[model samples]
Target: MICIHLGSATAKNLIEIAGAQTTVCLRIALAGLLAMLIWRPSLRIDPRAVPGIVALGAAIAGMNLCFYAAIEHIPLGMAVTIEFLGPLCVALLTSWRPSNLILAATAGVGVLLLTDSAGTASWTGIGFALLSGLGWAGYIVFGKAVARHTATNDALALALGLGTLVTVPVLLTRAEDLPLDPWFLIGAVAVAVLTSLVPHAIELNALRRMEVSTFGVMMSMGPAVAALAGLLLLGETLRPVQWLGIAAVVGASAGATLLADRHTPAAPETPGEHQPIRPTPSEAVPVP
Candidate 1:
């Protein structure tokens, strides 16, 4: 929400400002610092896991970059709704429960309503949003693989490191557009806090106390949250139809999660480990 408002308030071109190249660099740098300060991943090298970690970082970077780009061209609410397809896809892909099909269909209809409005809709932007969703799905799959081989703290740090390395080239190419003004720096920090650090910290803490299905159900409210943020921060009002669509998507996501929780077996507890149960088939793990 902050990013959308800031980007719009500025005279910059949204595509150039929020494209795959720029956001990747910024997120990599910001998240890398946060993860390193918080986790301090061991310097030890795991030769076998390096490739997977690199791929995971790349996917994470791609997801952030693409989603920011999509939002550059669409309302934050609409962008979030479309981008949410990634996790929804992950949920449906892993589950075979017949009941989830209805939830999936409902989400699909909501997305259609979100993107089909004549005057406000941009097909190109919607295309970018879909692409962002695919990237997010990729991020979750690869991130889970990385998490399996290392601690979340270490894995996230490494992923950010790799992402930063991957994004350096693009950052250099766009150096001229980089903001150096003190106020812009302040705004960027605010964006980092609102979109990245705070959410990551809160969610990570929450995940320690919750199940994957429960977490999924909770996170399904993100679009609605974003909508609320948009209303408060940007004075963006949703039409009745759009509000209905938002409700449908939120309801379906929550319903699917609840159903998954009821039917899925509880995760096994490890002996001597006091850590909370981690959700399987992780969702977007939002960076922005």
Candidate 2:
């Protein structure tokens, strides 16, 4: 949670100069490089998995682009609170209980409070955030699809690389805006590490030791964490109502995840290999 917020704060600090496109391109590009170097995934992957990889890569690429663009137009906390609807939707879709509908309604009210559309919030930004949420949902679906065909790390590395490729045209247009100063370049690299490389490494390790359901529930705290990051790191304060809205979303996420877990059966552990669960895009953001 902390690392995810830190990465978000770091990107917000850079977006003024780098712009959303450049920031996302560099971050994912660097992440792809790091993953390739570390995993050295087979260059000759099975052909059957290409479509899943492409879809997952597109999801990651689209998610980051929309999400960064969203924060560019809206407050960090509000944007994240809205973007979290993706995973929340996934959690709800997994179960058909009446409680899930209540949870969904709670999240909707929370979003309404956060948007307060009649006031200063930009509907355009909200739209982008919603699109990002959709991208996030696609990410989880395609990630699982790809995992069914290949090793997790290899698929992820390839996805990162392919995502970077998908963003290349946009990156080209913004390439001239990329910082040339040594310190600024360093800051960009640091953001990449903080946002992508570090989180990927840590999440990969953590998944080996934790259950997916537990991780999902913990991830439900993302909105609160992002709100704190906005307050502390970005010096952006939320109104009391906004805070309540955030709480509602977080509570809904945790509740939905727990309920889904209770209703679903756990997969048996593999006999010998210590296989980690495939990560959702949200889950990829390291907690600390």
Candidate 3:
């Protein structure tokens, strides 16, 4: 995740040189290419897995585009916090426990405060951030299904390949302005490796083992990560409340991740009473 946002900060730096659409098309395309080189998949996808793969690919494309558009207008951390709504929704909807609710609310309060800190940002940035959040939610929901069939690296590789395909139109539209300068190209390669390749592959591996809610809580840390990235890399300073928000989100993530795993209670059963078997944490969120 740190790699992901660091790549994003790198892209943000290049936006002025390459424009948002062009930078994003390049990032996705290059990342997909690297993933393909590593995985070298046969593209022999199961019919059942097609929908999930397609959805994940589309979600990646939309999320990347919208998030780039958002950061073009607002700071990276602010945009990421707004985008957290997507996974937070996934966490609550997939499984509901009182502990989950409290932790999610803590994260929610953090988002509110962070949002408040960005008092003067335009609605356009916020709207794009919201759209990005929706795309992220779709990514998480469909990603699990894809992982089940394709495994980790292949799943992310194939999805990024599809996302790269989606960028063809944009790339063509911006072809005239695209840069070939060696320095910029170097940064782009780093961006591809950090944001597009490493973080997503990590996410796929993590999602395969953990419950969606656990994953979501873990992902709730993204805002903090992005915030720090923005501060350190881009010099985008945060207000005191924004720092407070990060602390809240971190606390919620720590508590929920531990609590969700540790608290599987055994229901008492009488000799004749049949106890319904519960789904393991990873199985709680079904693809259907």
Compare the candidates by TM-score and give the number of the best one. 3
Candidate 1 vs. true structure, TM-score: 0.76
Give Cα-based local distance difference scores for all models: 0.59, 0.70, 0.81
Residue pairs clashing, model 1: 212-279
**Steric clashes per prediction:** 1, 1, 0
TM-score on alpha carbons, each prediction: 0.76, 0.81, 0.89
What tens digits encode model 3's per-residue C-alpha lDDT throughout 1-288? Answer: 777888889999889898888888899998888778766655776667788988998999899989999999999999999999999998888866778878888898888877876669978999999999999999998987776666566667788898878886778988887887999998888887777776787687667667777778778888999999999989999989889999999999999778856874433332212322222221245311
Off by over 4 Å in 3: 260-288
Give candidate 2 misplaced runs (Cα > 4 Å).
44-47, 97-104, 198-219, 256-265, 269-287
- Supply candidate 2's per-residue lDDT for 84: 74
Model 3 weakest 10-residue run by lDDT: 272-281
Best by lDDT: 3
Put down candidate 2 lDDT per residue, 38-156, tens digits, no spaces: 66676676677799888877888788889999999888888887887786677567535577667776776676666543268787888998898899778766665665556667777
Question: lDDT: which is higher, 1 or 3?
Answer: 3
| lDDT tens readout by residue for model 1, 1-35 | 33333432231232354454564466557666656
